[model samples]
Target: MIGNVPSDFRLPTSDSVIGRLADDVVLSIEDLWVEYQTPAGPMQAVRGATLEIRRGEAVALIGESGSGKTTLGLALLRLLTRTARVSRGRARFRIGDGRTLELFSLGGSDLRRFRWQECAMVFQAALNSLNPVLKVRDHFIETARAHGRKDDRQTSERARELLRMVQLDGERVLSSYPHELSGGMRQRVSIALSLLLEPQLIILDEPTTALDILTQRAIIDVIRSLRQRLNFTMMFISHDLSLAAELADRVATMYAGELVEVGKVRDVFYTPKHPYTVGLLNAVPPIAGEEFTPLTAIPGSPPDLLAMPSGCSFHPRCPYATELCVRQAPPLFAVGNGHQAACFHWERVTRRLDVWEGAVR
Candidate 1:
């Protein structure tokens, strides 16, 4: 949670970072279910996804592709595609003014207005969203003008400052086309553009994917420093739990469409409570310098949402699954503290894990 905006702070007449900013609950999401209208039938991409992202914290959403992590992020921003829509859910955003914006209720124009001013998303392959023909500065200029900034001169200077904040040269980047910059440089430009509006919450959807190791490190470092300086809350989504651990304070594991486990990063990593989570952590390779060890793969593929299993979606693959797990879907059961898991065998699962953990580690 963050402190409230200072008394002297004010919303600018034009597009500027100065606005109502507060700490505490930035966004609250309840039972968010997003679906796609397919030719066969409606497929639920996100099922009863409930989460809360506090202000000034980094919460990482970890799952494989099609686990609904990306869909949930887009839903928070109300940016899901035409084929996809939120069937049922509520997302409330607490702006800096101590008022709330019901994010799920906003229409297209209202959503556009709310975005960037209150929240922004640094999308996957965001660099590709940039125009091939337009210079980088033109992109910033248009984003500013869209948000009602009249002074091209002031927006231009702010754009340059944002570029510098991301460690890119303002003059060179402003004059260059998207292709003129390397992938990492273009990604930096995308990050800078997202910050152009000074959004209170930034949804980074695998922003580090597809980059070389060295480039990834540089980008990660830049993001870490920027987050500390700017003090915006974040939802960092990734498939690599090890990589997510670098940036997140907490970790939420999604299986199929629902969150099967969530807790502090250290707790989730070192003392996972879910069988699926145990499988995930054990799947990661041990460090090269350590004693030689084997890695275990989580058996079977993810379920088909169109024809999901009757009970727990993971019971088919879970070794500890019992007959009850096969017949009745388990709700997210609280173990202790903030940790929760959806399993019929949460207690027995823990005991089996000791034997399992010894084998894997």
Candidate 2:
């Protein structure tokens, strides 16, 4: 029903309905590894990351500053810089006609068409993403034209509709240049441009970065509304845990260039099995607490990607880490239904939380 998708292409009626079909995989990544060439050595940015995004669901990748969340997102779209390469991986993306396309294998016009027509990305810096010389309307016109949509009237109307969905005055916004708009306005314009192609999967990297708290709230609201109405799959990268809890059905925690934990939002937030995830939760201040709860910072900074620690990458900071954790990296172990954590002492993490809660009382 949207843009260039086949006439029979159908999305679920509601964004709330996740896992509607067992085979409803919009995107699947397996053993994906990405590295950046550097003077010292090749820095591994994403390591053996595997994930499946169901149709019409929002998945949030959360972690500390150098946790490889952005790298993974960029790799999925094949938008990595020249210095970076997908060392080895398979990114299978389902197209409108139900054909799976290997993103890494796409080349020439096939890769270009896949970029915006099937999947679009709204990068972190909205100002840097837009052309200073081009007016907002010109941005839309150019994007549509590049994607083979040359009908000026139809493209303008579509852009207006998308801008309005993000709660912008389409006419005024379209007339203004990127520099003429505020930060929030520019961000909204980027969001509008992404939807102009009616891509089924949208990758939003730090959507609310550098915005005021009020403006961040507005962006989140707009994204939520758009997802419910349009019913598209989304994967947003962020360090904000609260935002992930609010916007995502699933939360994937990345650490040291690998996914350390993944589960339903409630499951990950309430009963996290990974020590790294627990540390992240402890760092965030609770909103509904009666007394002033002290926030606990995760011990030590993120490890150097170029010279990562042996065994578990997080073991250096994990309290429950043992001799085995120091000698062997743990693979993702099943924690709960559709939940997995890369931790050798997952049971100990649960027990530690129980003890912490009792002490808090």
Candidate 3:
């Protein structure tokens, strides 16, 4: 009896009410491997990694310090160090307007041109990323100018609009230099600059780690609001699982240099299959009253990248590890739709952990 549904309305998915669009993958990394020539020896930082960042979705890369999250992020922007090299794999980055390109094959000039227009990065450490000599206005102007927009008035207006988008005072922040602003303000400015070109994908590497609690919340809110307004995909990298869970639609857990698990945020946090992912969720401070008994922390430290362990890197720390975990590395196995984990004892651990109170259904 009902007529055609409204354009905005849609059928529900097994996951969310808004059904995922057709394969419109924006960024695709297949079998990626990045290695750095260290003083001791050549060390692999990212090993056999595969991920996809769809348009309009926010994905988080989370792990402990030295987990190679930053290194992998830098690889995406093709900003790796001199000694670091992408040994294998291809990262296919596509813009939202249906233009697809292979990032690995891009030349220096072509890559530079695509940086601000197709993709942008909000790097860690605002102190080093921004130019101390230039005013914030000039920084934004350079972004616009580099992308080939020559009008001064248009550039200024665009810069102000971007600043406003990140909830900063355009006139005041524009006039100030990077050294004059607080850490939070500097981060906000960096974010504003990243958005100057309205890039389809924004890669944030610990973008809020320098700010205080209040400022961190504000910055996160701005990111969420901007994503909703602009509908651009984000690849947010952070060590903070709680914040990542809040912002990202999907979460990927990295250990040493390998992706151990990746799945929906709720599934990873509430019903984590990977032992490393379980440890991370257990460490999050729960709200008062909703707290369970003192949670368990992983026993051992992460493996050294210079000499990664054979088989599973996390086998030393994983409690449910077996002989197979020590002798043979496990490939990512599907536990549910859109959920995968690299662990041998996932079944046994999921049953024994007592982490999830409810059944997955």
- What do the candidate models score in CA lDDT, each in turn? 0.82, 0.87, 0.81
Q: What stretches of model 1 exceed 4 Å from their correct place?
A: 1-23, 350-361
Q: Which regions of candidate 3 fall more than 4 Å away from where they truly are?
A: 1-23, 290-293, 351-361
Q: Listing every candidate in turn, what is its Cα RMSD in Å to the true structure after a full C-alpha superposition?
A: 5.2, 5.9, 8.6
Candidate that scores best on lDDT: 2
Q: Give one digit per residue, the lDDT tens place, for model 3 in 184-265.
A: 8899899888888788889999978968999999999999888888888899899999788789999999988889999999
TM-score of 3: 0.89
Candidate 2 lDDT score relative to the true structure: 0.87
Query: Against the hidden true structure, what lDDT does model 1 obtain?
Result: 0.82
Those runs of model 2 whose alpha carbons end farther than 4 Å from true positions after fitting are: 1-22, 351-361
Question: For residues 1-361, could you state the per-residue lDDT of candidate 2 as single tens digits?
Answer: 2224454333323321222223599998889999999999899999999999999999999998988999998998888999999999787887766666777877767677788889999999999999999999999999999988899999999989999999999999999999999899899899989988889999999999889989999999999999999999999999999999989999999998899999999999989999889988887887796898776666677889988889999888777777999899999999999999999989778624443432311
The local lDDT score (0 to 100) that residue 272 gets in candidate 2 is: 95
- Stronger candidate by lDDT (1 vs 2): 2
lDDT of 1 by residue, 285-335 (tens): 756676876766777788999999888888877877778888998998887
Clashes of 2: 0
